[model samples]
Target: MLKSILLFSLICLTLLTSKAQSVQWASKVMSFSSEYSDPLLGKEYRAIHILGRPSKYPKFSATPSAWQSLTPDNPGGEFIIVSFDTAKVVKQVAIFENFGAGSITRVDALDENNKLYLLKEFNAGYAQANGQITRIRLANPTSFKVKSIKITMNSLRVSGYSQLDAVVISDGDSPIEDRIKLEVDPNAYLVKENLGTAINSKFNEICPVVSPDGKKLYFTRWKHPDNLGANKNQDIWVSNLKDKKQWEKATLFPAPINNEENNAVCGISPNGKTMLLNNVYGKDGQMEKGVSLSFLLRTGEWSFPKPIRIQNFKNKSEYSEYTLAPNGKVLLMTTEMKDSYGGKDIYVSFLKSDDTWTEPKNIGAAVNTGESESTPFIAPDGQTMYFSSSGHVGYGNNDIFLTRRLDDSWLNWSIPENVGPVVNTNQWDGYFTVSAQGDYAYFSSVENSMGAEDIYRIKIPEKVKPQTLVQVSGQVINQLSKLAIPAKILVKSRVSSDTMQIDYDPYLGDFSFMWPTKKPFYMEIRAKGFVTRRENFDFRDQAKYFESVQLLGLVPIEMNKQYKVPNLSFIQSKSEISKESYPALDEIVLILQENEGLHLLVEGHTDNQGDWDENLKLSLERANQVKSYLISKGISVNRIDTKGWGGTKPLNTSTLEEKRRLNRRVEFSFFVVQ
Candidate 1:
């Protein structure tokens, strides 16, 4: 009876769990087309390839000239809604062309009061005859707050531009959401954000990954005033939110997890048990900021960092900055591969079941180029990949790009769309991360910053999001030469040599390291032309301005002679040297030159490579070789006494090889006081 009751209870739990997985958020429309076919395969591949298109495209009809409205005033104008608890959070509306022509003259986004928030006027006289997706941004949009949005277009009156065709609308959750929306989405989701106790002294935080139970939040804070000491920089910080509505101010995460150095976090796994961070603990006990990053994992109250294996390290070089997937199994970081798309491509390493990292593979040509691609953020669905790219066609420098996984590949990308006017500016914008639910995004920028660089929180307009990360950095330059040598730098445990290890960029000579505020670690760097540098750092107890410049150069090997001479003795009182002393003949010649005008008795000794008489004869011959070399170097023949003793002197007696090798050596002593 007890067993039956337990089985029933387990079944009840299964049903409850399965019911929770039914919830899902609407996905954005992404498409592509092959209107311009391959010039090489015309007749063989006749059908036009379909680029991903919105579901609202009209059905093809036999009548090519059917009457359809394309203006914003048209009832079917393109629109999409982000919903929470069956209510609208925000709506993104598109109205240009679905299957026809459209030259957009002016685009405006309106709120409930019909007030304009975005008024973009464009002269698209060169718009193609093919359909295009027009984006609109909405404000304060909530699960029920955002009512509706409109898109207006003006048709060009010239033959150069195509005629405006139709408009369409969709209903779902916002393309981007926040912690609250994500938790309430399909499944048992938990998304956390920054809640500060202080207002503006120095409030910087991001990448808040919550545990599956939704009790803890792990994040990173940089340049906070409390963290400003003689060596303080960036460190991992954490907080807990009790209940769904209450959040506490963050505190320095536990010890053995942090060091007196800079630690920046990049990605966190769903369980919150492990996360990836970049750390720069210099060999001189200094924390490096802005260019060296590595990975770390958390266990109980302690978080430890271990360097990526087989990553090359020289005398002093840097290579640690990277991103992590939600599962903690896919690592996306910058590296130099021979066939790289460009500057720094985002390569991925999958964690195999055997606990070893798979060989890193590049994301390939579709999303990468000869330009820099970095800071990859993979959404929970494991399909929507967000990253920053500089070479892809976009509106500004280093624009953020989004791509959908098509079957097994990611070639089907939305024609790189700018995050519109609100999120993008003329300056640099990269290094961005998002909540699991796809609502809110965190990024670092100087646009409206209070200092050199500050982190910012943005409630994205429903249709777009900023790039995944804003690169925070400085570079390593030669102190004496002031020129950068793309060297490889390393960070390891001075105690066990098993902790975090990473390599530096050979191309840029830069590094980006992130870590937790839990443990103290030792940093060491080695390169081809410099001495190994060492430093100690504790994140749990940090210092301020954790920055340093390491000056290093090649170390030369020193040659001196408090040199050990061979045990040259007579064999059983016989005066002769062993044969093994021949190798030391060169040293006797060196001794004569080093001490000019000095005379020497070349004594050879043997512990017993053979019997007494045989050892003595061999030692004699060995001693003569020394006398000959000295004479060859222009030393006076009468100033040298070549003598040998075999089996008479012993350094050690366990074996003949060791004793003979030691005793059958050439020695130079005072034959005549010089």
Candidate 2:
């Protein structure tokens, strides 16, 4: 009898192993439903935990521990349903009952048509074990493939809820090895091209940063003989656009920018005048690493690099790489800070009024994952961001992803989309930057390259193209001397209320600003001993990609001299101020506050578009509107007087609409009333 029992046991085990190997299991879950879930173990785990591997520890439980089993709130008449992305011929089902094992009484399978088939029914005779796999073979295997499984549990003897550690299923057609292989879509297309010998050398090149003007490319090359340092370390190199698609031969940046120590170009300002470099220099027999800021002088030479001191960024590991937006008010960086979800997460810091950086905030999970994220690049538009991540599901090891800022809060972001295979591969891919026009993307790659790493350019896909931004660049000069004036340029957007202050190049008088969206903008130029100059930019129908040249000449403030307020627009034939006129009016309020002892006259003029009587009344009401705004700004009304010149004082006598538009203006003259 003993010999017969041993032979029967061996036969049963052989049949079980053969059946398990004959079927393929589903890899992805499509739907999960549970009648009730334990408060500690949420519904997600209660229904989907069976798809993952079993935990090693069965007796001990902890929050977020994989070993914890899924339990229902109520034990009687409870059910758990789980559906897979694809239908499979499930021949065997196994359940690991680590806790509350006796609560499960029956199991059923469902086909694609939602028709359920009974699989097994348990009785009190069934024995429960701690962390034991109980395999249930269907007595009458269904002819159709199964798409989902439903487990029902009911118990009267035990008041505790039903618990499950894991569930395993075996399909009838595919083996485990075939099921584990990942499938790549054959329809996906990604095309990459080399940047050519002019920009890439036999040595390693990486971290490409394109200037906002899209005429210059700056990058880091390692172990090159042209490096100033004898240590064969990294050095900064630059290449200028020679033609449409051709670049001049790469050359090392002038001294001080690329020293003997290891130096790498982190980023370049939108104007291409400020460069952020990472320098690893030795001091007191120890290596020191920090980011240094180098400004391009008016003489075409870089100033001595000064190390940037971030308030809380003390350790070297806290920051890995960073990029500055075109406006220089926002900084995007990759760091291994404590708040990071995993490896290296991206964070952003805003420039405070005192010129200090605010505390860096993590960009949130929509862009970060449990893997490393690095090499962030904010486009000129400032809304879209490109970065490399190993955490997000992508084509390869490290794929580039793009996301747009959803709101004013830095933490709010849209779901990150993979840039696609054309720019991403199974190998590491990152450090992506786009041109000012959002037409081409610049990045470093190792494939089909002249060196370990080479810079490459490719036309950006329309879907991922960043929103276009307009570069407003011009000169600030003195009206009297007709020479460059060192002044402060203040820009404010009427719609967004975004403000930026930039100082003109003291020697060159050149200043540049970036407008990220199509909105009205107000600009003010202030210089010592000069009347503040104000201008407006109306971008209602502005081209998506182009630069606007604005030349501002500041006049000396004098008595009985009138200065035209460039951008004050009123509703047609009415005194109501247009939304676009707020910035200019705000500037007038600032001027009044600064010149407290000065008495001013607010004059309103209108084009010869309407009846003379209506024009006169509209102009007077417009001037009163100005006075009312000034009073609202805490200015004393007695110091201001209003006058309506109407069509009598037209700046331009031409009949053209454009000339008439220019004639409609508001002029203010200041005088010292003793």
Candidate 3:
């Protein structure tokens, strides 16, 4: 009797399992055209959104997942191919089109081997009006089984965009209920892509650091024969973003930067001129446990890595990582110390005036957990911080998390949130870095790597992306020589009062920095045998700027020569000062104040469109306005002079309105007040 009852129980269990498995949905999206790049958008437009149960029709389509093909979006063809997890005898198949309907012209069913033999075609179908829960059932109680389905849609048939919410399959012909239970898929977007052979080798490639321009990529390669330390230690390798947007073949750096000991790139300045390395390099190519900087020299080669001394710098752990903030004022390190909360914690050190860094301060418990926290990277915006930890709740052994600084104190930060399941993983996902644009995040992954580990990058949603920043570049020119000047550029934020110094590349007289502020930012350019020039870029009113570029010219500071003030106040030929001119005038005032021995001459010019006498009078009034402004800011009135060139001294001979407008300008001249 017991044996009979056990057999009956086994039969019942098999039946239940089969019944549960019979209700299968489109498990995967194989091919799609005109899909949204970001998973959050293109409701019904993204083909991947149809992976599970139907979304019970679209009320407001954007609120739920749906697929939409761009209208006139992809010219030649429009189609989607979806496959199921299990092939079962199908009683009915449903296509849920909630929004712009009747784009479907044909549907095909494939067998287990992807052989398309069964299909249904519609004749000259036009778009139908939007309907609630529009379920089009095809092939009910069919003779054979199906593994996948293909859908062909035409936006031309539909006057507007078409939407597809879900494609479901059931073993029985009866319609699927609205509340049918479906399998939960939390980490849906696990699109693990390999960075390809150009960056990955049979060995391990980790610690990715992409340049701000998004053109250069740097990573650490270990256990490779080409490594300087050979298999035992890792060395830095670089690749260029070539034509077709593919990364070029990676090449290893030689001696100076990569010695026999382990060498890695902890940070790269936005200008691509400075790099922070993992270990301190000796003049003789020997290395020690410390941090160093390798600069791009005038010869176009990397300079020997020089140690950057930090007060009371010590790491209890053999493995440690560090990052230099884009502003060049802060250094982030992940190390174990006596005061660490646990295995490892994130700490910050600030750059001092003496070219050294202050002692490391713990980042606080909000970000660094009781478990290890490694690989900290602060975005160009400075507020958003990314780090990896095993202690935080995540989908992997080690995952990357992003947090924002709440106030001036770096200790106060929002609770760390996992970047996402796709970016993080079941295995270790760290050494993450982003370009200034913050569109793609480059990271190291061991899974599917060409060798032990490989570098990969993925498009991130805009919500988590770093705040948009402007890329500002300029050259430091000598007053007399008219040649490029290698100088110390003092960059400061008026809002945060944060100051940092960056070196100008003398060879090209070129310098670059990221501008993340929506307020006044100043750059004080200083070079040997030349006067200092201060430049201010005010973005207070124009907060809409994003991923923009600004090119600045030479620092004009010759004794008797004139430099255009570039104040836009005279653009309308009006004497009333615009707020745009305030920053420019402030910059001049700062330069004068910094050099107490300097006296100033303010000159204004106007276009030839107006009468010479009136233009001259207006110009003089403008110069007086500037002088009065300077005096209001504490400049001595006795040391300043005013002049007006007017229409007689037009810069351009052209009669065009635009060219004539260039004559209306303000200029500054400096001399020693003897």
Q: Which ranges in model 2 have alpha carbons more than 4 Å from their true place? A: 1-190, 279-287, 314-319, 478-482, 517-520, 527-534, 538-544, 562-582, 593-597, 601-668
| Model 1 Cα shift for residue 468 (angstroms) | 19
Best by lDDT: 3
**At residue 36, what lDDT does model 1 achieve?**
20
Please report the TM-score between candidate 3 and the true structure. 0.58
TM-score of candidate 1 against the unseen true structure: 0.36
Clash pairs of candidate 3? 43-66, 44-66, 44-67, 44-68, 45-66, 45-67, 45-68, 46-67
Judged by whole-model lDDT over C-alpha atoms, candidate 2 comes out at 0.68
TM-score of each: 0.36, 0.66, 0.58
Ranking of models by lDDT: 3, 2, 1
Please state the error at residue 47 of candidate 3 in Å.
Answer: 48
For each candidate in turn, give its C-alpha RMSD to the true structure in angstroms.
22.2, 12.6, 19.3
TM-score winner between candidates 1 and 3: 3
Kindly list the per-residue Cα lDDT of model 3 for residues 1-674, writing each as its tens digit. 00000111001122233344355668688888776543321122356555554432323232124566755334465788888877767766677676766777777788888788556665555435563343445555556678888888766765656667667776754555332322123553356567888889888898898888888899998877877754468888999998877899999876688777788998888888889899888776677787888888767788888888989988877777888877777888887776665566788888888988999898775665445789888877777888887654455667777777787657777766667656766688898788887677888877667768778888865546776677777676665556666677888887886666777765744577777756478887765434556677776654432443433334545676787785544765687677777877876777777667778889988888767788889999889989988999999898799998777887898988778778878887888755
Runs in model 3 deviating more than 4 A are: 1-190, 229-232, 476-506, 517-674
